[model samples]
Every structure is written in structure tokens, then in C-alpha cells.
Target: MTDGIESLLPPAVAIILALITRRVLVPLSIGILVGAATLASQESSGPLSVLTGTASRFIQTIDQSVRDWDHLHVLAFTLLLGAMVGVLESSGSMARMISGWTRRVSTRRGGQSLIGFTGLLIFFDDYANTLLVGGTMRTTADRYGISRAKLAYLVDSTAAPVAGLTLVSTWVATELSYLQEGLADAGIEATNMTFSVFLQSLPYRFYPLLALWFVFVIATSGRDFGPMWAEENAAAQKPRSHHKQSPAGSWADIFAAVMPVGICLIVISGVLVTTGLQEPAESEMSRWQYFGHVIGSGNSYLALVAGGGAGLIAAGTLAIALSGVSWELVIMGSAKGMLQMLPAMAVLWLAWALSSLTGEDQLNTGGYLASILNERLPVEWLPTCVFLLAAFIAFATGTSWGTMAILTPLAVALSINLQQSLLASETLLAASDMGLSGGSPSGTAASLAMSPICLATFSSVLAGAIFGDHCSPLSDTTVLSSRACDCNHVLHVRTQMPYALVVGVTCILFGTLPASWGVSPWISLLISAAVLWVIVRMLGKHPQSAST
Candidate 1:
């Protein structure tokens, strides 16, 4: 359906029902059916025709999604990672690591902070961060009586923002390309200024920076609010007798945990490097640029799959070698972990199916949004509005890359027009005031504000995409965060929503709005932080039973 409002329905329905039902699968399935039905109704108005169209379209969607190599690749990667986690758990690697950590970091706050900080430190790749940090830290969190949902939150909260901020991340290349394209489209000659521009945007990256601060504040303050508080409180009161390991299992070898993860990283790096390896032409200048090009263009999904497979093999071998676990048991545990992923996989499939409905061949949701907003959107307000739009689109489609790819050019073009319009308006005003019919210094000043405004919107698009992906149930990182932390997917979504929203709202209101209105980014950060503090203080309370 090319209908703009209709395009929003499926994801909106799914999100609402998910919140109300506290379950993702049924809602997602219904959403998929509804979307297909919508598509069918577009073909013919009859209810019977719609039913027929939905069945055919739904089957086609599922089959096409499953058969797509990219989809299969991601599915394989996710399931293998789950198997890897299962192997780690059975080998007592997690238990031993957690037991020692528990002894040293005795308090729940310390434990939570450790997990949060670890996620921040593992910033090179979000997938690596989510699976490695969340997977390993879950037991430690449980030992300290932290809720699984809270652990998932900490894991997810740090993954995207940290990865987005880091220079050498998988995200960097993609982000740079989009920005370069936008700048070029805006007639800004940014030749070889990629790194410089990114560095400048660093200060303006209020959402991610503030999000990191939000996590730290919660951890250090030992306070929580919103739905998260209730869960944290209940988790604290629950006895951890089941989490405690016997003295025998305490001797589980560190190598059992370390080796598999090491191999995973090595394999992923090796694959990306090997596959993306290419010689630069004699015309090329910098090695750094060439290497960046290599990394930026690499197939991250393939690399992840390579890592997952290697990890599965290494983990199984290690468990058999060090933990004295039987090969059969290791295999069985791995199988069980793969099976545990079935529910998330089902949800993921439906999410993917829903996304396809708005693609090039289907209804063009992004283009529709652009068309509708083009007439109504003002130039000065472009940054804030663009940020909000990117967030909603990313949340709805559950695809940050898709959202950015669609919106970056549009945002950049809009910003340029807005700036030009402002310059023209200022010139007219200056001429009218001085009784002179020519351009003035005010126009030049307004023209200068153009690039900054564009940059701010670029930052917003990036920030909003990350935030939307952060809280989306259809997001792979969100799903993996729950899988890694062993929390219910919907429950994790519920508990984590408030924290994400606070950072997001603050970034939009205090950061984007003021930054566009001649306000400095540093001031925006201060205001955003102040807002977060006020909200958290007024609403967030220390969960009563949290372990000291």
C-alpha cells in the first residue's frame, strides 16, 4: 500500500499489542497478517479477496524471507551464538567467572556498574558487545541479585551508543559514507575531511553521550525508576540459592570461557580482513584511508557468521577438553540453546517480513513520509523534526541502516534549503531595515549557520536511529540483548523503555531543539544531563531489596 498512514499501521499495531499483551510473538504474527491483508486489500476491495491475498502474500513473505541468503545468514549467526552461550553455560565457564567476580564485587550496584562499563569498553562492534558482554555478565548480575531485564538493559544501552561513538567500529564506515553523500549532495566540498567532520560531530552527539551518562547515573546512584524499579525490586527479593555454584564447579577453568571468545574475535577479524582485502591503486594516498575503505565495505554479517561458527566449535572443544563434559552433553546443550532461540527467531522472522512490505517493490514508506513532510516542514525546525522522524521510522521498520540510508540525503537537502531560505529571508530583512536593496552581513552569518544546522541534523539522524533501534523489539541487537541476558524479550522491552525514552526525549528537547536555535552543543549536553537528573530524581526510587 502506497498510502502513507496505512504504512504505519502494522508496526504501530504490533508495538501497541506487544505493550498490552506483554508478549511479542502473537502480536507480531497478527501484525504480519494485518500488513499482508492491507497489501491484499490494496489489490481488491472485497473481504474474501483480501483474505485470499493475505494468505498468499503472507506465505510468500515468509518463504521469501526464509529463502533470502542474508536472512538465512543472520538467522544462522543468531542461532550459533545462542549455541555458543549454551556451551559456555554448560562448561561452567560463566559460573566460575561470575563466582570470582561476585566475591570481589560484592554489591549489586558494583556488579551492575561492572557490566555497564564492560559494555562501554567493548565498543568496537555492537554484536560483539551484546553477545560477549551480555552473555558473560548475566550470571554475575544474577549472583548480585540483579534482574535479567536490568542486565539486558545495561547490555543493550551501552552497545549501540558506544559502538556509534567509537572510531574503529563496524558502524563508522557506513556512517561516513552516508555523511559524505549528504555533504556532497548539499554542495559542501568535504574532500578528505571525513575524520575531521566526525570528530567535530562528537561534541554534538548528545544522545549517545547522555545515554552513557544515564547508565552511569543509575549504576552509581543505585536507584531506579519506572517499570524497571518494580522488576529490580522483585529480583532483589528473590533468593539466589539456585545461582550459587557448589565448590566443585568453582574450579571451572578460565580458559573454558576465554578461548572460545578469543577464537570468535580472531575468526571474525580474519574473515573481514581476508575477504575485504584489496590493493589500493597507485593513485591512492593514505594507508589509513585504504584500510578504512576495506573495513567499511566488508560484509559484517558474513564475518559474524564466521565468528559464530568458530566460537561454537571452539567452545565445544574447550568444554570437552577442560570441563570434562562429554561431547554428547556439550552438543546437547548447544542444541538446547539453539532451540531456546526459536521464539526470538519467530519474532525476528515476522519483523523482517513486515519490513519487506515497505521496500522498493512494495509501498515506499520513506518516500511517502518525505512527500508528506516536504510541504509542511519548515527549514529551521528541520533538525528537530528530522530527528523525530528518523526515530519513528527506525522504530517502525526496526532497521537503523535502512532508516539512515533513506533519510540522510533528504535531511541534508532539507537543511541546505532551510539555510538558503534563511539567508534569503535575512537579506530581505537587512535590506528593508537599511532602506538598501542588497545582501548584508546578516545573510552571510545565516549562511554560515547552514553547515552547523546540517551537521546537527546529521547527528540527530544518527542518534535517533540508534535510540529507536535500542528499544525496538524487532531490532536484532535488542533481541540479542535479551537472548544474551536470558530475559524475556517483551519483558526486557517493557523494563528498558523508560530509560531509553528519557535519554531520547532529552536529546530531542534539550539537545536538538536548542542546538538548532543558536545554542552551543556543550550547553545542550548540560541541559540534557540536568533534565535526566531531574527526571530520575523525581521519579526514580531506590528499589528496596537490591543487594548491598
Candidate 2:
């Protein structure tokens, strides 16, 4: 499985089935079962034993994943967040918040921007961003004739990209850790260079940067293409329904909803900083390095749990005190919210199990893909190639973090060695002297600068991971976005793909490719944006106009 193309089977089965059937659970289950069977078949067992092995393998993966404290922490966070939402809804806080938002965001553009900006503001965790944005903004989007698919797109687009790109977020730690580990594994001293390289690589992360810009383009321009336009147009023609007043509505309804979210954000940020500072620091580490180190070492999942609990408590207290609701009502609200999350939790659990099956320990799907890039090629093409490879792996595995973990070390080592090998060759050295080194500095200065190939490939992994996560139906963030927006999972995937592809291709063409050839990333980004603007104006349609 590790060495063969058969490693790609499980995810292929799952993704193909999901597309054909337009369903999630059945396809995911079948894919997992198939993967389990493949693993089981490798053992010397009788038919009966092999059958039992398949079942036992499935059970073990789920059990092991659930037993992990990190997984439990995430689940707990989701549960608590759900409880907070329930309290808000049951207490009429949701309706009040919606009403307030509706008045301020009179048009579809404002409503969409509000959702996008809120997502950007919550740049700490993708899970929190997706859940908070999708759940809170769905109703307001509905009022503005925005479809569930559109809401899901906005939420999904902003969630991972923001978390991945932001200076301080749950993703920052994992990303830095992976990059550091990759550098260390490549025999590079990472003490000072890891954070520095990461900072340099940020500009090369064209997908996330473009994706964020594309979101606002979609938001402010009020134009859409493909299935999203159809969804939006249909939604526009449908009469807007008035929200029902809660029997327990009060003057503090808006306060009740907004306060809990604010408290959650504040508590999470406070915990992140505090916990980060608590980690062991090196005297030699600079202020920025120490900051990155602190964040990279902090217990982010714990912070999520603490923040969720605090928000839940605030919501319950607000329901009881401000809304003057009964303790029973508060309890029910909490229970109700938690219950609503059960389906998504189940999806997450299955996703984790499936991810485990495809992980380095199991099928080694990522490893197989990594092995294919062993052949040498032009240095400038590495970023584009790496981006595509990372995208495919993430799409198959449905986890951006997993894809990064698998590819980062390999990409770093490969790029460094390739560059060294090329520099050693007389023919290549002559070309490098002739300015074929992609605008790299000459002589000793070139040695001091970060390798353009390394930086671009590094950023490509992050960018591609996000790209695949956005389009993949099996992705947890995608699932969370669908769940939060209350959109059909398959529908969300289907509608969002066109918009994702448009930005994805544009960035690859105008951002990564040119930038790799020594074009400044800022210039590439500007060209990409201008191209995207042309695309939207030429290809996109107004929902209201299209409906008429």
C-alpha cells in the first residue's frame, strides 16, 4: 500500500461515490470499509478471519482516534459551541441578533461582507470560524436572498485560509511545527531560520491571499457564476419570510447573543497568549521568534475548550438573567444546541476515522503521492507541481493539516537537494550565471537569501491544502461549513467548486508561476487580482437579474 498506486483507492472511491451519489455517509463508510479490507487482506488469514479483521480494523481506528485527547478536545469544543448556540436560539437572542443585522445590512452585498469580515476577525481557528460565521450569518443571508450554498462558500473560503495565513491562530502552531520539523529533517539548523523562512513564504501563498480577495470580490460586486448563481437566483425569487418572535423575547436579546461570542473570542485570545508565554523561551530567540515559538507551543485545543465553556456559561447566564428565563429553559437550550451538533459530530468522527485510515501509519496515501515527484525538473515548476500535488492529496484525504504533515518534510528536503544539485552542475551553473536562477541574488548574497524554490514550494503546500479542503466533500471544514450554514453537504461541495476553481487556476497562472520565475509576488498578486476582476465582470451574473 505504501509503495503502490493502490494507496489512492480509498479516497478515490470515497470522492467518486460522493460525487455520483451526492451523499456523504454512505460513500465515506464504503470507502473506509474498502480501505480496511485492503489492509486486512495483507495479513495471512482465513476468509472468516479476514472478514472479522475488516470490522475490527474499522473499530480500532475510530477507537484510537476517539481515545486521543486532542480529538476529544475538539469534540468538546464543538459540543460546547453548540450548547452556546442553543442557549442563544432558545432565549430569542438569535432572532434579535438577526433583526439587528438585517437593519444594518440592507443589501446582499453588505450581508455577504459582514459574513466575510466576521470570518476574518475570528482568525484563530478554522473550526471556530466556520461554526461561528455559518451559524450566526445563515439567517441574515437568507433575509438578503443569499442561498445556503453561498453562505457555505463564504464560510468555507474564509475559515482555513484566514487561520492558515494569520500571525496568531490554532493553525500557526501546527504549520510552524511542520515547517520546523521539515527543516530539521533536511539537516538544516531550524533554530533561527524556520520562522524567518515561514515569513518569507507567506507572500508566495498565492491561493489563500487570492482566495480571500476573491471572497470580497464575490461579496462586494454582488456577482456569481455557476451553480452558486442558480442557488442565489432561486433564493432571490423566493419570498423572504419574517422571523418568529420568541415567547421569551426581551430587551437584552441582542446583548445575550453578541456577548457570548465576544466573551468566547476574548477568552480564547487571552488563553492563547497566556499559554504561549508559559512555554520555555530561549534567551537567544528574538522577540518575533519568541512570539512565533510561544504561539507554536501553546495549547490551542485547550484554549478552544475553555473558550467554548466560557461562552456556554455566558449564554446560559444571559438567558436566565437578562431574558428572565427559567433554569429549565436554560438547560433545555444548552441540551438543544448540543443535540443539533450530534450529526456534525458524527460526521467529524467518521472523517477522523477515514483520515486515520489514509494516514502515514495506515495506507500511506500521501507517501505514495510524494514518491512520484522523485524525478528532477526545472526549479521554477516545483511550486506549481507541489501545489497541484498537495491539492490532490488534501482533496483525497479531506484534511489540510494531514496533507501538510505528509508533504512539508518531503518538499523541503527535495527542494533544497535539487537546488544544491543544480548549482553543482556546470551547465546549470552557467545558466544560473546567465540569470536563469529566477532573479535570485548573485554570488554570496544568493546563498544568504532563502531559496525561491523552497519558499514557493513551502507556500504551495499550505495554499494547495486549503484549495483542496475547500473543494473536497470529505473535508471536515467543508462539513462544518455545511453544517453551520445548514446546507446540504453535497450541494455545498457542488456549488462551491466552480468559484474555488476559478480562483485556484488564476492564482496558479498569475501568482505562483510568474513569482517562481523571479517576478515579485506583489506584482503577481496585483495581476491576479486584476485578472480575477475581469473574470467576475465577464462571467458572473447578478442573482436578481438572472432570476428575472
Candidate 3:
């Protein structure tokens, strides 16, 4: 049966069904069975022999995959991050920071600005962005009579979008390292493409940026979407009550929470810039040597440890001084906070495991799609198509980093191929010119001419992955935002989807279309942002009538 359905059912369908049914183990089993059945059918082997061989092979594959756990550094990083977040929250540092900021904001619009600004500041790290902004701003927004859904929207919108756009951050360092490895595998030089080039390409990341802008426009203009709009309307229709107590904290509390994060950002940025500029040696080292010497030798980890440790120490000191809590109570609170985070951390670990499982086969489904696209679609339409395809994949995976890691290299490869073909055509024309002038055309000129196209395609893929992650319900940041704001999970999803879709569709039409027409990505992005601003303004003025 597995063999029979192999051609009929798509791989994605199998994975999705398995996930929806809460039976991931079943899918892996089915995949193995299918592989064995297919092989046996091809080799004329008996069913029993096929089953035995397949089971053995599956065990071997699983063992080999498990042995590769050395590469799972992100898990360790996340654990440390969890511990740091626990310390900050337990010490009441984050609460004080939020209180101080919100106390200065007199109006709802001003409050929204503070939220957006905080999101931007925390963009250096997505985990920090989500935890800090969401945890801090929730109470502040509530004091301003803002709905939890709106607060969640603000936090979720800013988290991934801001982090994705930042050129000098941990997010970029991790992504760049992965992207560089992938490009190297394809015989491309990562150094040839500068960080400026990537940053310039970010305007095409329509979802997150648009989402951020939409939040500001909606908050200031008093417009809402779906359930959020209904909630606001209901709140406004109710009787007035006495003003709530000030939710703001003291200046001392704010400094304690923010100082460590600020120092970490500065240190990380300085280290990354210095390391990125180092020249490669004349002779290339082995894979292990390169990993150990260049990548692992960096002091960023030390910086993270130091920054987090300092934050814990400062927070503990502040708790004692400001709250006048006994040392025993403070220790007890910290332990409780750590325990509270365990469940969230468990979910994160499961998410990581699922991502790893999905990404186990490096067949480059995105690249395969790009190849089919090259054959079926016109060159001018490639960027737009790639954007949509990447969006769909990221949405399904609910992991932007995973999506970018898989799709960017494929897009880069496709761009190189497309540019080479265009250059060939141009070269043939040059040959005709040479024939008329009695001189031969040069092939080297053609190769140099195609570099721009490769750059454009790479940018498009990055943009698409971010767009999908921005709106994905399965995204961890999205989940954290909802939890932080204390909003209904489904309500948050329904409200944000339309805004994301509007921005995404417009980006596809304006952003990618302009790129296809040979406009510089920077120029195209500016124009796209301008266009988005107009649309957002119109929507803000006459918001759609919807219920929570």
C-alpha cells in the first residue's frame, strides 16, 4: 500500500497529515515502509526480505543522524537564553523597565510608539525580542486600556521583522554562517556578496516590515482587524471606570533590565564585524579545521555567557535593593521562574526536533521547484514565483530560519543559471557584432555580466521566507506573542492573517514585479514601502467590520 501511494500522495501531505493527527512517529514509519516497498518492487525482492532490509537501513540512518548531534548548538543557546530570561523576569527587572517607559507615554498612540521602539531595540536577538517585549509590554498596554490581542500583534509583528532586517545581530551571524556554507557547497563565494547587499535586499521582506508598519498605523488610527477590531469596539461601548493604578516601575529597575542587553548587543556586533573582515588563508583548511579555527574560535559565546551572567547578577542585586526582599525569597522566586520556563523550553525543544527531522534530507525541494519554474515560467516572472513558493514552504514549516536556510541557496543557484543563459544570448549578439567588425567575442565578459541577477534572486528568497514566518501561526515567536499578551491563540491568528496577506500580496505585485523589470532592489523596496503606506492608510481610515 505504501508503494502504491508513493506516486499518488505528495511528501508534504504525508508530513502535514502526520502532524495534524499528532502522530509524527507514524509518518516516519510510513516513510520507511514506502521506501522499502518501492525498492522491493524495483528489485523483485520478496516482501519479508524487503521489510527486513528496510528496517535495518532505517535503524542505521537513525543512528547516523543521531550521531550528528554535535551540530545542535542552537539547543544549548536556547537553554542559556531560557535561564537568562528566567533570571530577568524573576528579579522583576523587565517589569520595572516596562513601567518606566509606559509612565512617560500620555496617550494611546504614544504608548504604541514605545512598544514599537522597544521591539526595535530588542531586534538584536529574536528570543530576547519576544520574551522582553511581550513580557514587559503586556501589563503596560493593559494599563492603557489596550486589548491583549492588539498587544500581542504589536509584539509578534516586531519580533521577527526587526531581527530579520538588522545587519549586525546574532540572528544575522547565524543565518550568514549557514548561508555561506550552503553557497560554498554550490561553488559560490559568500564573501563576494557583502552584508550591505543583503541589507539592501530586505525591503522585499514584505510580511514582517509591513506587519510592523500596519501595527503602528492601526494603533494610532484606532483601527483593528477581525477579532481585534471587535474587542476594541466592545471595550469602547462599555461604561467608563476609574483610571487604573500606574503600571510603571522606577528608573533603577529599567537600567538593570536594559543595561546587560545593551552591552551584549555592542559586544556581539563588534566581534562579528571584526571576524567577518578577516581574510581567508591561501591554503584552505579541512572542514573540521575551518569549523574549529575560524567559526568556533570566536569570542561571541564568551560574550553571551558574560552578558547573561552579568544580567543575572545585576538583576539579583537590584531585587534586593529595590524590593528589599530577603536573599532566601529571591532565590525561591528565581527557582520558581526557572520551573515556569521548563514547559515553554520543552515546546521549543520539540519544535527544534521537528525542524531537524523535516530538514534531514538535503534534496533542496526549493531548488527542484526553482528548476521546474525555470523551464515553465518566463525569466521575468521567476522572482515573484520564487517569493510565493518560499512563502508557502515557510508557512508550512513555521520556521523562517529553516525556510531561509533551504531556499536562499537554491534561489542563488537558479539566479546564476538564469543569468548565465541571458549572458549567452548577449554574447551571441556580441559575436554577431564581432563578425561584422571581424573580431571574436569574449566569453569572460558574459560571465561578469550575470552577477547582478544572482544577487537579485538571493534577495527574493530571503524576503519570501521572512514574509511567511511573519504570519505563520506555528511560528514560536507568534506563539510567544499570544502568550505574552494573554490573547486567545486562534483570535490572534485570525486577526493578523488578513494584514499579512494584504502586505504579502502587494509585495508580490509591486516589490517582485519591479525587481523583475530590472529595478534595483533598494529602489524597488522604497517604492514598495511607499505603496504599502498608502494601502495601510486607506485600510486604517475605514477598517473592515469584523468580530473577534
Best by TM-score: 3
- Top-lDDT structure, candidate number: 2
Measured on C-alpha atoms, candidate 3 has an lDDT of 0.56
lDDT of 1 by residue, 53-76 (tens): 999998998788677665576677
lDDT of 2 by residue, 316-424 (tens): 9988888778899989978987787676566555655666676555676644554554344776898899899889877876878656755665566556655654545
Q: Please rank every candidate by lDDT, starting with the best.
A: 2, 1, 3
How many clashing residue pairs appear in each of the predictions shown? 0, 0, 3
Give per-residue CA lDDT, model 3, range 62-146, as digits (tens).
Answer: 4443343322333333334445455566677666666566667665566667888888776555666777788777756655556
Off by over 4 Å in 2: 1-100, 244-375, 426-449, 545-548
Q: Over 4 Å off in model 3, which ranges?
A: 1-83, 124-143, 167-174, 189-200, 223-230, 240-248, 276-372, 394-409, 417-466, 469-476, 542-548
Regions more than 4 Å wrong, model 1: 1-103, 242-378, 428-450
lDDT for model 1 comes to: 0.72
Model 2 vs truth, CA RMSD: 7.9
